[model samples]
Target: MSTRGGGPDRRGVRAKVEAQRAAERRAERRRRVLLAAGAVVVVGGIVAVIVVNFPSSSSSSGLGPEGMALQTGPQLASVSSAASGQTVDGISCDSSEQVAYHIHSHLAVYVNGQQHSIPYGVGVVEPVPSTVNGGTFVSASQCYYWLHTHAQDGIIHVESPSQKQYTLGQFFDIWKQPLSTGQVGPASGHVTAYVNGKAFTGDPRTITLQPHEDIQLDVGTPVVPPQSVDWSHAQL
Candidate 1:
């Protein structure tokens, strides 16, 4: 009888050891689950940081190919004569050295020295290309205008690189509503101009030019006459 009782006690101790082993295994599995959850959280935070710092790929910007949001407002700049070495005002300026833009909208054009504002962004009915002696020519619709130095032909030509059927009048019409004027200055002997705060990259500059130099300023986009729309869409 005693021997049999000892045997039963030994069996009971073995059963307890097995149960303890199973409990230890369950505890280990719970620890593994917690560790995995922590790792996932850490990795997710790292991905979020990378996405936030990425650059934007949008149109209508100097940086991107698409139209993207930008900062625009009234800026200050000057348009000088390319031929006579004189500072031409809006009234007596010549088409070769100066362009007096008339704005149909109620927008204000503050002159370099004049305290009161003037009317800009109006008058011309079509877009025409006028080369400058020093500054580069660009269409307003493709992008904003930023010029350096003065050219002989100080005119802003209205033309669309898109070549869509739109009138120069229509383009400037849209601009008069939202556009503001800025200034053109010099840097390292190089004269430049920025219209409507479009050129913000280099140091802040103004519009100044040597004799016979030209600076082109775009006040609006050129519209393509409907008769000129290329059926060349067949090229596609």
Candidate 2:
């Protein structure tokens, strides 16, 4: 009788020990799970902060008006002062468009790897009629400047009374914007210019507006390659 009772008591003690060990294992697993979840939350919060502060080029944080992608549509309106028929950089704003020295050049601008639109009617007078073309603004003004743009298609129309040399600096002058080695309009950075898909090492202001010339200016990092426009379908 004594031996049977002792055996039963030992069995009960063993069972209790086993149960205690199982409980301890479960508590350890729960602690591990809690730690892992906390780690994930911390990591997620860090990622969100980085995304908001340093948005990538593909991010919509830097989009232009109407949710337009940077450099893909009209970024700026025609300078208001330009409509006053004031002579800028020796270029004249006449009552009518000149055709004697009519020619076209393309100017593409990029700031921090994002393209910006050169906008229609850059040198045209106010109250200009505009239409949307492929999400871009196209304008036709009765009064015109020697250097004017009819569309936000990056085409610069050089229409003068006579055929003479015109520089990119003169165009910015008409646009009433600052241009230099460290800035392009309102964008400030190290200016890198390209002419006809070739890197230009000289002052961007000195860049001549040749017929059908492809001029590109990049400000800041992640420099984009010069883009070419097909002139076959473009009516100057």
Candidate 3:
């Protein structure tokens, strides 16, 4: 009789132990869920940190083969001429003692139909002083790249490497200014680009820099006769 009476009690204790084990399992699952959520949050925070520390679109840029998203911004250094001397990216610059090449091109920039003067010594590391009413675009400097301006007349002197295609956007990039369809440095308006007096339907960055080729960019209304370079008067 006593043994039979104790059997029910034993069964009740076994059921209680089983219920405790089930509750423990549920609690463990909840802990795992919380841990997984925490890991995701931590990982997300780390990614955000990395992105902010990396370079922005306004700096550190390169043009693709098709001139896609060509960043017309400042460079990491002065093309690092000090480190590499007269050659970079397998391209050579003017000699340390004298100008090696003197190929010239014409460039015209207008904002609201008003012409903007290209500054002299724009790409030079040691810039020459500019005088009022007249500015030398390409001021003599130690490390002269092929792309430079000698005066505000908008003539681009490819005085470094020879027989290499340069782009108009690269000139702006070296000038440390923004160039886009909607903006050119501080001038902001509708931009229209022309290559050799013909309307450029492609990205402005694709304008191939060529000798005596007139590249005009108007930001605002189009001027009559098109603001092209005066080939007859261009100081080639």
Off by over 4 Å in 3: 1-102, 129-138, 222-225, 233-235
- Candidate 1, 139: how far from true, in Å? 22
How do the candidates rank by lDDT, highest first?
2, 3, 1
Task: Judge candidate 1 against the unseen true structure and give its global Cα lDDT, from 0 to 1.
Answer: 0.29
Please give, for residues 79-159, the per-residue lDDT of candidate 2 as tens digits: 664545677778877877789988988889988988888876688876355444334443444467788776556778899
Best by lDDT: 2
Worst 10 residues of 2 by lDDT: 61-70
**How does candidate 1 fare on TM-score?**
0.29
Order of quality (TM-score) = 2, 3, 1
Clashes of each: 39, 2, 9
lDDT of all predictions, in order shown? 0.29, 0.77, 0.60
lDDT of 1 by residue, 1-236 (tens): 24375587788888899999999999999999999999999998888886677544331122111111111233322222121222212112123322232111111222332212121212221223344322233222222221111111112232222222222223222323222233222101222223233332332212322221222233322311111111111111
Which ten residues in a row are the worst by lDDT in model 1?
Answer: 63-72
Q: lDDT by residue for model 3 over 1-236, one digit each (tens)? A: 24376587788888999999999999999999999999999999998897788746444233221112111222212322232233443444444423455567666777776667554454555655444222223355566656765544556667663456677777766665667888876778878888877888777876877868877777787553465343442325
Best by TM-score: 2
- Residue-level lDDT for 21 in candidate 3: 100
- Using Cα atoms with residue i matched to residue i, what is each candidate's TM-score against the true structure? 0.29, 0.65, 0.53
